[model samples]
Target: MATELRTAAVAGSGAQARPVILVGFQAQGNLGLGYLSSTLRRAGYCVELLDIELPPDDIVAAIRRADPILVGFSLIFQFYIRRYGDLIRTLRAHGVDCHFTMGGHYPSLSSRQTLTTVPELDSVVRFEGEITLLEMVAALAEGRDWTGIPGLIHRRGGDIVANAARPLVEDLDSLPYPERSFAPEIVLGHKALPILASRGCARTCSFCSIHTFYRTAPGKVVRTRRPAEVVQEMQLLHRERGITIFLFQDDDFPLFGKKWRAWAHAFVDELHRSGLVGRMIWKISCRADAVDAELFVRMRDAGLYIVYMGLESGTEEGLVTLNKGITVAQNRLAVQTLKQLGIMFEFGFMLLDPSSTFESVHGNVAFLRDIVGDGSAAATFCKMLPYDGTPIKDALEQSGRLKGDVCAPDYDFLDPRLDAFYQALARIVDVTGWIHGHRALTPQLNWAWNELAVIRQLFPRLPDTDAYEAALRNLTRESNDLLFTVVENVATIFATGKGCEPDPQALRRQCDMALSRLLHERNAFMARHQTVLLRALQQAAA
Candidate 1:
């Protein structure tokens, strides 16, 4: 099946040309690679995907088998660059002479430094990669001059040559759907899938990198695929891949407001016509301002099971400082609407920022507690880090909030002072205990419900009920272990002098004990609610 899929992918007039191999999520699972692969394929390049998280030998074997003339790595996080370096070194050790390259958020912002570190990399495709990579590969494959490619950084003799930046794809509708055929099949258990409907953000939030990278383009150029095209792809997935739960990977899926509603209705109508309306559930990201009661109802009716939102800060000052461009009232309204619609969601919170004080942090915590209702939602809160090319980093550099050159990828998220603040802040939020208590238990509850639904679907015949129940029971125990591990780690971090303390050893042990107890209580709560939670999930599935 894999071979046939690959053959069909390259069976075109352009199949005679040398293939371009694209590596994605070398160590972590991310969405950028999918976009790159889709764009490359659309531009008439045969592409191969390699997930470096697989065994080193497997990656080497795949590279050897594909024998591509050019390779491109898509990086979303800085830590993954080191993994790419390892792959590059391994390739060299095996005498593979393919030209190496990369482009994504990190490289787009810090192109010069990235080019220097991995000189083995022949070039770096900067900014929007679809046009840049397509141009680069065509030039190389056809043995033509490469100087005209706008978004390329290459070495000319001993000097690094950077061409003019390419403008963002103004009409995103022109791009092809992401080549999901290139996605590596990893064990995501219940088949969680990520999909993107659009690119670029409309807001210029201070701590975000999306606006800075896309700021070259005018306001929100929020382009989207036609509703028919999106529905066509969803139908294809349903028929071909058994994907029933899609997690929209768009930064802001509903950025166009009313336009999104129209698209949603069209999408649902299409699904209903195609007989796939009730076959799958989906989720998407939305801004607080984009969501309201009417929109939530439309979304829920269209089979949206979840809607992730960036409720970044709670305090008015924190919101203003982050330039979130939305008020707390709007945030509350959005959350309430989602809850009223019976849609589940995960709200991301940026816990500690530059302007954060004890009072502000407490206020943020209060806001989180109120919304999360004791952290029941599949929500996450973390300290803010300055991604390169964000307005916050630029502002911090100008105001001396950040020291030294910002080009290096070694910016630590846990500076001593920041760590201390987070440590204190976590106390207010109780995130450590929350994570320890809830992380493991919730998935088990979810799995239990899913198994029961599957049984009911296949009832009377009853295929391996004992096996399914055993799996759920084992998963619940495994979840408990994972929670305890988190509790231990958080406690150690808080207790150790290396993390955020003066008394060091004594403080560490004390914090560990306190956190352990907190987690234990949380575990007890999960245990008590496990049956009710599973039943609710079963009911939802029904």
Candidate 2:
């Protein structure tokens, strides 16, 4: 049911005309937009990528000048949905009647909801957008009815209609490397080298949103670009775009087991063969089980500078509860391997799972202390949240333990209680790092502490470090001050339960103030420490 538009020659020239404009996140450093722009250009569309981070007026002016027949917006983060809607409204107010289409994680999961919210959106691409969007542009260019295009959702009269979801692309190598040339020089700036070597993850972590997308299709239909193709793209980015830092934005780079090893070997061989082995430095996300000393050495030799691993929990039970499919042992080994290889790494840890108890929380701290000994390891911790469509949310909902609606903004991955704890721990960790004179951990720790203080002020009765154990006594006093406020507020609420009428708005305001403080403090910390953190990271790698 898919149709390809025939190329048309211009009146004055023999060359064929390409679709004039394509808007995407050229400035946001997102891989989805890069893929879309590249695929569209390969399909013979003249693409102009727009950065979502730019001002609304600037975006509007660019769109007006381009006067594109097709305006494609790549939606990656749910946080930007409202902002995108505002921009669309602006475009409409300016009498720009271009066909608006959206693609990305949010649209892929909740197509109907997205269409309902952004009624101005002419269509939404449900899943893997490269081919779907390419086929759509062809149909639109040929003036053909697009009702038959798979993975498309359109508004029909008063109803929203979705075509069948498209099949996953099996041979990922067939797709052309994402076109970076379409991105504006200013938009790319100095740090814009995002690449993807593989697609889909094998692990079924209960709290992750990745499953929501992969579940659309059956089985482990993971695909990877050939090693030569991956290396070629890197060379092109370096030679043409002046890009040096290549980040492999895959969920799990080594999903195909030993297949990744083969690819890594081949990739290194290809880089050496092409004489561009040292032209760029690269980073990739991988499971703890995927890396080893040998593999790290190979990757580092081939310009792989950083490896990001998700060490979700420190306990076996926590790992099982989250269905991470890996153990704490593997996580430790992975970190050790990276360190031994002299390759930089970033460790991801998640605290505050539904099953997490005080024991598990303490275990996490112990595990961190052991692994991050003397500030030699680089790691970051985040609080767990039950994202929509994840098994964790489903299990919690089924067990009747998950309170409130999952769609509520307040129910984000980092709930207030856990958020405060993580913030405090992060600050303690940062301050500890600073005391040790490990500059790399200072910014991260300062940011974490400021955030903890803000969240503590906002949510009065949350527990603090002193209440937990003596090991974290360094932060005990600060924790007591934060926890006392929480206890006092709880006392007030309980005392008013019988005959005293309490204003709900007052309680809500207190909660809102806490959240605002957390946000403000976190931002201030980042503003103060971003440059220092970047410098430390750079120097550590050097």
Candidate 3:
């Protein structure tokens, strides 16, 4: 099946190329491109997906070799404009140009502007692209005029034309499952794959663009798949590719609204009907208010292991500023609830957003303490970024506070002192926790927890695992406390070092020492059971 999908495609009248190309970032998964590929293949056109991270020379070489009828580029972020331009220039310079077009959240919302920026792109496919993209390929292959197609922007004659918008996919299950390599990503020893149960977010958070994106298109902003179909896809992947760790990549897993709850309940029922209780585990991201004890208990029994919430801020004022509908109490209650239910959880946090002050920063730290102080999960956060299409970005620009350009949009803090505090805190965390290239502390803890989850499921009688989990939690607690102290001390010093030690090198040394110790403890514990762990992962997928 895998081989057939990888090599399958029926040719069009004029697009009898070896492999039709679709380019995007594939660091972990690129399901957007996956859907486009599947949609085109369903209509009898071969598609190829290429990662944007590949060298320009290599990408050009692939296009030249395939000589595809149409090349689609997936641009998710506005900052990627310059990079895509450089790549397109290279492709054209190398004499490898066909029809160039792009689509994604950023491009979809700002189609004309993006066309102006990346002029080489012949057109832009706005909003959902499955139907639109297929329509485009058919038109291009049969030499049909495509300027009037909905959800497409392109040049006609001497002027750029903006066609009518296309309706969003109303029935998600009516579409085919996203095309995949079927070569699963490895999590500890278990094979993992990402799936989505729904599309679009219902919330209207100020900094978020997901709801805004869906709203611009014509249809129900939020749609879900049939529960039986979702379970059927999972069962198929599990049987065919040995994928046991299912990650639901829903913007908001349909667990909040009254109508959504019915869908959620049916999904749980389908999982039970398929008897997937003890054979697999899954993870999902959802809003905090949805973390109910009773409903989650049913989900937990049906193989739910971890839940991630967008606990963006812990202070009421910060939540207000960020336009998160829930209060600080709701966020705290959700975290506490998850812990009580014995479900592992992680969260998205922003210590500094568009609105920031010294007091708010301190309050955020206290909130972080409330959640991760007990070491139920590791602490991780960053300042909020004003991306291209978010509501906050428009607000910032209107208020004349938008700093930087389209590529790297930013804003000045209300107080310059807070700016200084932000820069200092960023350095500290960047060094000790969230380093991009390397395996940093926070991700280490996350992976360790995931590994522990897999182990507990595979070996319910595995002795000493509880002690290992406890030690891991204690280390996480310690790490969170130290970082909170460092953040507080740094902020206080920026506020004139009130009640803060002025030690500089010592703090850095302490961070290094703690990180080293963390690695040592985790490694020693795993090494002690290396032999057992070796077989654990093998049997997990087997």
Candidate 4:
């Protein structure tokens, strides 16, 4: 699949020759690699952007076909570290001698460990990869010393040398827009482009690695693109690609407070002046406390449809423990304001963490219910996974709660009963229609929502009054219903003891049956809706 995708991308780009190939893996488009590709190509280097979601053999085949000098993997998560390591080995075994390098969150945090463990990786670019990668590519091409390059870790002799970190790009407007043209298929929902209006974040959440990654450098933690510059990219994407949906991939969008009020007003004003706001809808993420009702109203009037907030926890204690710097009241107010303004919003919640107890878990459950109510599954909760460079992980390690190495860590519950209940809940959720093993439910739902959003955008283009939109919404409600049912069952076990049910296996079987029924219903719904949507699209086009 990856090979085919790469070939299609190359053909689309009208490139007749092999080029330097950069690999990236993500559920969404790889914006980091996109930025790198754009920079390198603008410097006159041929670059091919390949997503590593394809099978290993396909990846090897694609790289072999390219026969490029360098192959860099953007390592965003530790989960894929081992997988990419094996891939590098396979590529080497196939006599592909391309210099393999990796960069992103995991590599930036554990460059030495990554290089030590993954011997096949020639180097690891730390932090923001654009400048470092460009310099490395130049050095590799000209046979120059890449060791002096900042923000790089390269194996030298018997040891790995970690270089100094590169300074953050202060003038974000100086950088060109990411190269989406190399892989246009990566565009979400046909025309929805994932764009970053800013980099880094404002707040330092204990559980997040963003601040840690940025902390490696000196100076301002967050950087912004000029409002005019951002608007210019929107206009360009709209004019060139007919894109109508702009998903701002900013860490803290609108910077929603007094500190960035001038920037915010300028951005909103630019959106209005550019006339791009009239033609496109946008989605963004921001802190719960950062949002302002008045500013959001203006934004909504400028085609803002969705807002994603990191609610993280429901209890004030949980928020404090995570060092989220926002109160529970603030979270409530934010949700209420968005709701009052008729803006569609989604949130993230960490249900279980190192400090989780039965009481806290119960509070979280109640909080989630209070916010979204019963049968609202769009907002999903997750167990906090400790990534490298997070304060939470450091605290867990210091307290000896972590059970594994830095690459992969595990934590035990303070309460054995709560642990048992969590295990059971995970087992049921893994087996249910809601989630697959280890993968979070939110990403799955987000993927589904993106697909549906694309279809919804097309629905209005349909001349006939079709029921597909209703079907899609009904499917979402039904999915959420199943999620809430599972949540209630899990809550019951948490309330009572682990032995609350006389037969635990019976409860598991019931959950399984319910999930099976839901999956069957969902399949039928998709079939019905797809037929209606396809017919409508065809008719509208005619």
Among all candidates shown, the one with the greatest lDDT: 3
With a 3 Å backbone cut-off (N, CA, C), the pairs that clash in candidate 2 are 38-179, 385-413, 430-445, 458-514, 460-485, 460-486, 461-486
TM-score of each: 0.75, 0.72, 0.94, 0.84
Ranking by TM-score: 3, 4, 1, 2
Q: Count the backbone clashes (under 3 Å) in each candidate.
A: 2, 7, 1, 0
lDDT of 1 by residue, 1-542 (tens): 22322333343227435688887763323656666677667556777887767788898888888888788888777767777878888887888797788888878878888888787888888777766676667667777777667878888888998888877766655666666643433222224467666777777888877767777533345666666777777777766766666767777884456677787667667767776555666778888888767756766766677677899998898899889988998898888877677666667787667776555655776676567633335334666777777877777766656753433422223245445545554553353333324333343344333434433322233345454444444444443344333433444454454453233344445445544544454355446555655564454345
Give the per-residue lDDT of model 4 (tens digit) for 1-542.
22322332333343324467888774567788888888677666799877788888998998998898689998877878888889899999999996889988889888888988799888998887777777777766766777888878888888888788877767776565888743343323345678888898878899999989898776577888888898899889878777777888888885666757678878889998997765677889999887788888888888777889999998878898889999988998998888788676778889888888777877887777667663222557788888888999889888878887655677877877777777777776665434443234434444545544444444544432234434434555555555655665676767674534234455446545544544464456566556666665455334
What is candidate 2's lDDT per residue for 124-231, written digit by digit as tens? 987777777777776667778777888898988888887888877667776666655434322112334678888887667888878678777543546667888888
Q: Looking at candidate 3, what is the lDDT of residue 132?
A: 78
**Model 2: residues with Cα > 4 Å off, grouped in runs:** 1-24, 181-192, 218-220, 399-542
Better of 1 and 2 by lDDT: 1
Candidate 4 backbone collisions, by pair: none
| RMSD after Cα superposition, model 4 | 6.2
Better of 1 and 3 by TM-score: 3
lDDT per residue for candidate 3 within 34-102, as digits (tens), equals 898887877677787888998888888889988888899998878888899889878888887678989
TM-score computed on alpha carbons, candidate 3 = 0.94
lDDT of 4 at 306: 80
Candidate 3: count the clashes.
1
Model 3: how far is 462 from its true place, Å? 1.8
